[model samples]
Every structure is written in structure tokens, then in C-alpha cells.
Target: MRFLRAAAQALGGGLFLTLFVVFILQVTARFGFNKPLPWTDEAAVVLYVWVILWAAATIVPEREHVVFDLLWNMAPRRVRLGMRIVGNLVVGGLAAVAIPATWDYVHFMQRESTPVLGIPFMWVFLPFVFLMLALVARCAWAVYTALRGQGLEAELHLS
Candidate 1:
């Protein structure tokens, strides 16, 4: 499980770095050389999407996602646990429903190709489906751990 978290973080970070580098190169080429790379914009956009999705998945195990916890914090531990479980179930069900709908949307877009990259647009959009699925899994795991009294400590640190 730790390995999975680390791998997700690495994947997200690496993709984000790649996107930044490509974006900088594109900007330099456009302004400095007066010639822009045709595929750079499309590629950077695709990589950015991947980075955001993977970052969400990577951070989930750390309990870094935002939650309105004022009420939960004030509730008894048992109540909090129940709230967490119910929330996770609701989110998981939503994600499960959304995945197929998103896949259908992606399939609808499959015939369209990105202008510069010439790849099917679905390839770029499909990550949302996977991201949601990952989120559902993470939430379910959190509910499980919480039920077992093994909830992860909050990792939000104030600077």
C-alpha cells in the first residue's frame, strides 16, 4: 500500500515536471525563436490532465483532500466514523455511475483528433474516468480503515 502511494506520487510528479518543461520550451520557442512547436500545446495539456488526476489519487492516502470537517470534528468518534463511511459510500456510488457515463462521452469524442497532436481526443479525456475510479477506491479504503479503527492521521500542516 505504501508502495502504491509512492508510485502514484512519483507518477504524478514526473508527469507534472514533464508538462512544465514542455510548456517552458514551447514558450521559449514561440518568443525567442519566433517558431512554436505545433504539438507542444496539445501535449502539455494532456500531461497536465494526467498530472492533476494522478496527484489527486496520490494524495488520497494521506487524507489531503478537502472536507468540511467542522461538524465531524465536534461529533463523537463513532458518529464521525459513521459519517465517514456514509460519505465514502455516496462518493463511491457517484463515481461508479460517472465512470461509465464518462467512458461513453469519451467514446463519443473518439472520432475527433487533436489538431496538433493528431491523437484521438478520447485518449486525453479518458484519464478523468480512471481518476474517479481511483478516488472511489481510495475513499472505500479510508472507510474500511476507519471502521477498523485504523484511520490515517490527518496530514494537513499549516505553514
Candidate 2:
């Protein structure tokens, strides 16, 4: 599991690094050389989308996610557990329900290519499908842990 997590982080980092390099090239080409590369703009956008979705899905920890924790913090243990279960179920159920349609749409986009670079749209949007799957898996795991009478601890204040 640790190796898997490290690998996931590395993947996100690589995507981000690529995005940054593309951005630098775009800036340099447009200002330094006075000749902008249209392909760089498209590449940067694609990389930016991939990096955000990839990090959210695989690299970011669950505790790092933004949450409305005030009500959770004030709730009793049982209520908190119920809330966790219900919340996870709602999220996971929706993701699960949307998977087929999302897959279909992504698959259908294979024929369409980006305007500048001509990269297939399917490749660009594939990370969104991964994001949805990750959400379903993560929520399911949360629900399972809650059912097992675990993971109902109070949120810790960072400050």
C-alpha cells in the first residue's frame, strides 16, 4: 500500500512537472522569441486538467479534502457515524450510477481531437473517469470503515 501511494504521488508530480515545463516553454516562446507556439497552449491545458484530477483522485489524502466539519465536530459519536455512512453512500452511489454514462461519453470522444495538437479528446478526459472511479472507491472504503465502528474520530485543528 505504501509503495502504491508513493507511485501515485510520483505520477501526479510528473504530470505537474510536465505542465510546468510546458508553461515555461509557452511563455518563452511567446515573449522571449516573439513567436508563440499554439501547441504549447493546448499541451499545457491538457496537462493542467490531468494534473488536477490525478492529484485529487490518487495523490491527495482524504483528510486533506475540504469538508463541512462544524456539524460533524458537534455531533455525537453515533450521529457522526451515521453521517459518515450516509455521506459516503450518497457520494459513492452517485459516482457508481454515473460510471456507465461517463465511460460512454469518454469512449465516444476518442474520435475527436484537440484543435492545436490533434491529441484525442478521449485521452485528455480519461483522467475524469479515473477521478470518478476513485471517488466511488474512496467513499466505499469510508462507508466500510464507518460500519466497522472505526474512523469516527474528531477532526483535529491544524492551527
Candidate 3:
């Protein structure tokens, strides 16, 4: 699991760095060289999608994403525990729902290719499917911790 986490972090970080470099290349080519590379924009877009999906999955286990927890923070310990479990379960259910839809959509694109790169369209959505699966696992862990009496505030580092 830790290996997977590390790989996801590296993958996301690398893609983001690639996107940044690609943007710089695009800008320099357009303004400095007066000749833009048409492929750079498409590459940046692809990198952006991969980076965001991996980042979202990485944040889920740590509960580090931006959150509105004012109400959850104010609840009693026992109530917060229940809320934590419920919240995790809800998110897990959402992930469950997303898995099949994502898979089907990806499968539906089997015959298609991306306009710019000519890569299989399904390849673009593989990261989305991976994120959804990771989220499901993270939510399950969150629910387990909550059931063991961990408060939402504490789990999310709000306490």
C-alpha cells in the first residue's frame, strides 16, 4: 500500500512537472521563437488530467483536501464518530457508483482515439478509474477508524 502511495505521488508530481515544463516550452516557442508547437497544448491537457486525478486519490487517505468542517468540528465526540463513519460510507458509495460508470465509459471508447495524440481514448480514463478505486479503499479505512471511535475532527486533523 505504501508503495502504491509513493508511486501515485511520484506519478502525479512527475505529470505536474511535465505540464509545467510543457507550458514553458509552449510560451517560449510562441513568443521567443514565433513558432508554437501544436502538440504542447494537448500534452499539457493530458498531463493535467492525470495529475489532478492522482492528487485527489492521494489526498483522500490523508484527508488533506480542502474541506468545510465547521459543523463536523462542533459536534460531540460520539456524534462526530458516527458522522465520520457515515461520511466515509457515503463517499465510498459514491466511489462504488463511479467505478462501473467509468469502466463502461472507458470501454465504450475502445474504438476511438484522442484527436491530437491518437492514443486510445480509453487510456485517458484509466487514471480516473484508478482514482475511484483508491478512493473506495481509503473510505473503507476511514470507516473502520471511525468505528473504532476515531473522531472526524481528529481523523481530518481539525482537532
How large an RMSD does model 3 have?
2.5
Residue 55 Cα positional deviation in candidate 1, in Å, after optimal superposition: 1.7
Q: Please list the residue runs of candidate 2 whose C-alpha ends up more than 4 Å from where it truly belongs after superposition.
A: 156-159
lDDT of 3 at 130: 79
43: Cα error in model 3, Å: 0.5
lDDT of 1 by residue, 11-88 (tens): 777888899999999999999999999889889988988777767755554446666666766777777778778888
* lDDT preference between candidates 1 and 2, better one: 2
Task: Say which candidate scores most in TM-score.
Answer: 2
Q: Which candidate achieves the best lDDT against the true structure?
A: 2
List lDDT for all candidates, in order. 0.79, 0.94, 0.80
Which lDDT tens digits does candidate 2 get at residues 106-129? 999999999988999999999999
Model 1, 94: alpha-carbon shift in Å?
A: 1.3
Number of clashes in every candidate structure? 0, 0, 0
Candidate order by lDDT, decreasing, is 2, 3, 1
